[model samples]
Target: MHKNDTLNPELKHAASTESGFTLVELVVALLVISVLAAGAYSRLANTDTQARLASLQSFKATVLSVAAMAKGMCISDPQCDIDQYQTTSSTTIEGKPILFTGRYPVGLAPHGAGGLDQLMMPGKFTIQPALSDTNRATYFLAGAHDERHCKLEYSITSAQSNPSVLSVTVDSSGC
Candidate 1:
């Protein structure tokens, strides 16, 4: 074995090279990181989606409640409007409430559609007049997400209404 040399510097270096991570160790590390990242990304996307949906639902409920309050006060028109309804806006929806945008008006529902991704997506909310003619104002809200990456949508309908929700859907394809 010593025929080539009494002492081999190359041999010493090779032995030292063997000190850190083995091939298997490196591969395993990579695999573990990949798995962790995948899991994290998935959770993040789902939670964000759910939160968005919840907010939409909350907004819907808020609209309904505010409408009821407005009704109780016997004021859906601009005549008996107050300060909050005229000046302040909702922080979550539009940064600032749309002024004179009646918090909730009969047949005055706002339509909202957008993508809500806290970590990696643009959070959007669309508010448009509801497409129904119910005396009680209704807001149609839709949280649009990366069709291939997120899931966020919530619908509101009266228990005594028609077309009894033939289908209600929620998805997280983006994940």
Candidate 2:
């Protein structure tokens, strides 16, 4: 037998075939994986902002509900006046006296006793100081990109004569 013929048949066949990924194939696979990863990352990044906006919407609903309940209580009580916009009033809820301005609940106070925070407890949010006066309150998420830009503002009309205005505005552009 010759020297070349002495080699194993399987080894010679494998060497001739050379079955493996080429450089182009490997690069394409890597590129696909990177694209998929980038898409997933972008979706994940937006999820946080969506979550914040949903939370703010839920909180706004709660604020509206609380104000409606307070106003209902005020209307039912003969002593309480719902039309008085300039004067602060009180209504008993859950055996606790909640103060109100016209038909809307007031914001947080310095001593942390009487305000909208009392009615709706701050669960995952941080209650900031009352803006301008006790009528306006701002809430921020616990961990946000910019608290000032991404926040929920609750304001009640006190001195206005038109009607009681309980505004709950959410600014989630910076969230």
- Give candidate 1 regions above 4 Å deviation: 1-18, 75-105, 108-130, 134-138, 142-175
Model 1, C-alpha of 78: deviation from truth (Å):
18
Candidate that scores best on lDDT:
2
Decoy 1 TM-score against native? 0.43
- Measured with C-alpha atoms, the lDDT of residue 145 in candidate 1 is 60
Show model 2 residue runs off by greater than 4 Å: 1-18, 82-84, 109-113, 130-132, 158-160
- Candidate 2 lands at a TM-score of 0.80
Candidate 1 local lDDT, 32-150, one digit each (tens): 99999999999987786677667555554444454354333423444435432322122222242221223322232233421111111123433233423312222233444653233
Q: What is the C-alpha lDDT of each candidate?
A: 0.39, 0.76
Cα lDDT of candidate 2 equals 0.76
